[model samples]
Target: MTGDQGTGALAVLELLAQEAPAARIEALLHEARRAGAADAELAELARAVELARTVQASAYRGRDREAALAALVDTAHDLTSPYDLDSLLRVIARRARRLLTFDMAYVSLRRTDGTSYVRTSEGDTTALNAGRELGEGPSLGSLAEERRAPVWSADYLDDDSVPHRPGIDAVVRAEGLRAIIAVPLRSGDTTLGALYGADRKVRHFTPDEIGVLLSLADLAALAIQQAALLERTREEVTELERFGSVTNTTLTRVRHLWDCHTRLARMVLDGARLSTLARAAADALDGVLQVRDPGGRPLTAADELPDLDEEAVTRAALQAHTGRSPVPLPGDVWVAPVTAGAEDLGVLVLRASAALTDEDVRLLELAAQSVAALLLIQRGTAAAEGPVRDELLQDLLDRPHHADLHVRERTRRLGIDLDVPHVVVVARPEGGELGKAVAWSSSYAYRCGGLKAVRRGCIVLLLPGSDASAVARKVSAELSPLLGHPVSTGAAGPARGAAGVAGVYEEAGRCLDALTALDGAGGTASLRELGFLGLLLSTDHDVDAFIASTIGPVLEYDETRMTDLTRTLDAYYESGGSPTHAAEALHVHPNTVSRRLERIAELLGEAWQKPAQALEIQMALRLRKARAALRAHRTP
Candidate 1:
């Protein structure tokens, strides 16, 4: 029995001796396959053993071959998709974390202004304040800026020179992080950004890993470039669409005006009622241009369009008559002389919401030129005959008579549509410099015919067929910015008969008075709807009392000291009571603004607390400034 046991033990020892070492597993498998193992069962056993040995060897090396293959497949899929730059970058961050077995991953972009920003992250972005300016930091951005290459640190805690927050370091330690790998995202010569990954355990990142990250970043750069190009293309297309819409709308209105002109002319020459022709013109131009008589009176009697300023239009008409170059209005107003031949009949004015493109201007000029020739023919016929002359005369007489009858007669004889409802806008240039104001107002008036000037101020006429209120509002809105200050506007109600237009003129004059009162008081006011007292205050106010009682202390404070009380008041008015915005405008701290405003409240007294009283005080201040500026200039 002992001998048999020893033989069995020897056989076991032989089997153990033939077993392959872990390192030589692949070689042992090759050898076994090459050798002639005749028994099928034995050969199968050998193959199984060799396969197990090979897998064991791979595991010992910590090589996750299947995981690596899956990661490669995911990367290939990401590269093929047509995602935008930001999305692709996010994918890259996520994939990198998985591939490197990292705790966190992120991407950052450099700006032209020498600032760097974190754009994407696999972890909580808010934790890192991603996309915010890296004001003072030694981060991946600084490394990328300096080397323009990949950087890695295995012992970040040892590097005291690196600027990283203690909280970040604590998180890194908690996660068992040992190293970081960063690769610059570049395309050709341009460096777009940086991609980084943090490993949870100590490990050396091979060159192959960096190469893979770089290849992905290159793909991201391509996506960014394409997205920018697409955005630019969309903007261009949108602009073209807007331009087309405006042109179509303007052309349609012009055609309607031409039809109205023909009907009105027939009614006047055939001894039809003047009111009928005037009403037709008023109806045609309603909500467009305020039409008025030569003296700047509204044409429609009862149903008034909103009041409009017509000073710019009148100036343009006079300029055209004087043989000057065509004047341009604020909203691309185009004025063409209305004449059959050498006998100047009148003027044709066309307006556009946008600055007229070259093509648009040419088309409008052509339409105006045609209207001008028609007016001349009509005027010649009217001058030869007594009453039934042309459509222009009948249209003119339809509205009220103007104070300047000679100008009105000339307008009628010339066959211009003067019977339209219109308003006059007077503009007195501010800032002690009249040249710029004169030039702006003059050019603005000449483009639209209802515009004119009396002395240094300009008067604009809203046309008969236009929306008087809308036009006035638009004019005021446009002119306010150009004047660097608020401008006053007067609006007239609609008038039908020749006599009724005078009442419209008087209303417009009242509007002007209101505007003047608001301006003199240095207050922000609108005349859309006003109470009786508000209207009265706007037109007739106790000037001495306003200066002495209302604005007395603030004016005295400004004269006596260098305190910013006056400046604060101006800023408050300018910013419309937004303390934050006022602070920004004054270039001081917000707390400083709060303090100054508190002081201003105390100085102005309780009466100034009310909005109405505040408005009155503001108006008074502005008027004083305007008067002072005027006086200063007069002294010279």
Candidate 2:
């Protein structure tokens, strides 16, 4: 064992270790053959000689060399494979332990807030069981924060400045571990976290080994970023699907609303009462509107709606209209102006149970606009359809036996729902001012699929697919609102064919005359809720008695003074108690007209100026005229 010989032997062993183990074995066998030993001796000599003739040293060196190379290959394959973050990190940790000859290894990742977390680990049970929170000491944490490349600590436990976990120091001391390597896990300039490894004995980590671990950490960081991107993409797709489903459902509901509107329009065109249509519209809207008068007074509300102040809604509507913007209120409520062109129909207020986004607001506005258009279209259709239906009915009345199958066929073709029992409702507008009201009412009825006709000052509504009582009640209700004065509706029972319809029309006229007589006498009346005056005016005897009782004194006064008291009373009623207008109508001085009105009022008593009294006097006047005509006709 000379010093030169020893140096030569060490160099030979180092060179042999760099070669593969199998190649080294073959070189050893060739050396034995060159030594010229016999066949049996050569076999013994080949078995006995190590590369450097140091059995333990050579074996340890060879094993470590092979293990390192295998680890390098494994790590290369892992880096190329398409795996998720967690799976890829576990592979890195396991391979790191083998390549670096460490007791443990781990991958830590930085949270969004700059804190680092141990995401993967490979080690003995005691160290691995610390979970993800382990090994995030000051050294590793600082490396992540500052984006430092790598940090090495020899005698980690002895270094007071280096951070350590609770039992980590004890484990390091017990195992005689003396070195740690921390490499930053980075992608581009962004440092994600750190990869750490520890050896059981003091060892200087080479720059080459640190570079390899850093490269592997970079791959792990990329996987983490990719996983996050994939998750985000999945969320976006899910939201799109949900939006499509919701839009489809909304379209289906809109179609149902259109169908209801069509049915209601037919009713209006047929001159039917609009009360049923109003109820139907309310039902369709659900709680979309809280119906109120023009003055911001509440009229009716659905049961589910709270008792809201109409004044508040009106104020909100005014603000919205003035500003030309959607106005928000408490409880996620909003009000939109229901306008068509320049016409301000009203306001639609909505209370959403959830926060409304821009999309929800736009959709609701569209629905409101549709409703306004439907209202206008229905009104126009009813106006045009009313007169045509009335002319057809009149022609049938004039020639009962004429070949009028054309009218019947047209009615059938219009798809009128005539199967149900129906009645004729005739309303002779009070004061002969029913033309405009009738036009408006007919428009409304046509929109609701009811038939309306105007002849002279009277408006007739033919309610199909409705019972007599219901038609009567509905006609009274709808007309009452539009006239601003109580109107009497006469129901002429059920009728089928055109001839039957004509007969019903005549019956309705008779009933109208009777009801008008009652109304003229200042009486409360409706076809459905008729009182004693209804029965009294319906029969000839009762009609005579009513005339005598109500208008006999006025007639006597007019005949004795030749003052045209009837004309004076008419002038007073028409002028709405305006003395000047009444004087002009009577062609007399204002004072004179005023004095005559006072006298009439005094004679009729204080009750006569009231709506009830006015109604009674007007009915009495009509009854008196009808009696006079009846008597004159009989004498002729």
- Which segments of model 2 are wrong by more than 4 Å? 1-330, 383-387, 396-405, 431-435, 465-488, 494-497, 519-528, 531-636
Residue-level lDDT of model 1, residues 368-481, one tens digit each, is: 333332232222222222112222223333444544564466445334345675543333333445554544443344334333333335343433434445666656665566
Please report the candidate that would top TM-score against the real structure: 2
Backbone clashes counted, model 2: 34
lDDT of 2 by residue, 1-636 (tens): 444334434444565557545556456557657766467655454444453446445456435444543454455445444356677778778877877778888777777676666777787545533354434455544554475567777767776766677645565565556787787765535677778888777778764466556545544454455355335534654676677754666555544544554454444333333344444444554434443333343334333347655567778988866765567777777776655434455555666657666545644454444344344434433332444445555665566565656656646644455445657777655543765576566654554455666665667777674455566665556556656666666666577666566666666676667656655422223333343354443422355545545556776787898877777887777787788998998789998987787777666776777776578677777666677788889954
Error of 2 at 586 (Å): 63
Please give the clash total of every predicted structure, in order. 76, 34
Lowest lDDT 10-mer window, candidate 2?
Answer: 521-530
For candidate 2, give the lDDT of residue 389: 49
**For candidate 2, what is the TM-score?**
0.36
lDDT of 1: 0.52
lDDT of each: 0.52, 0.58
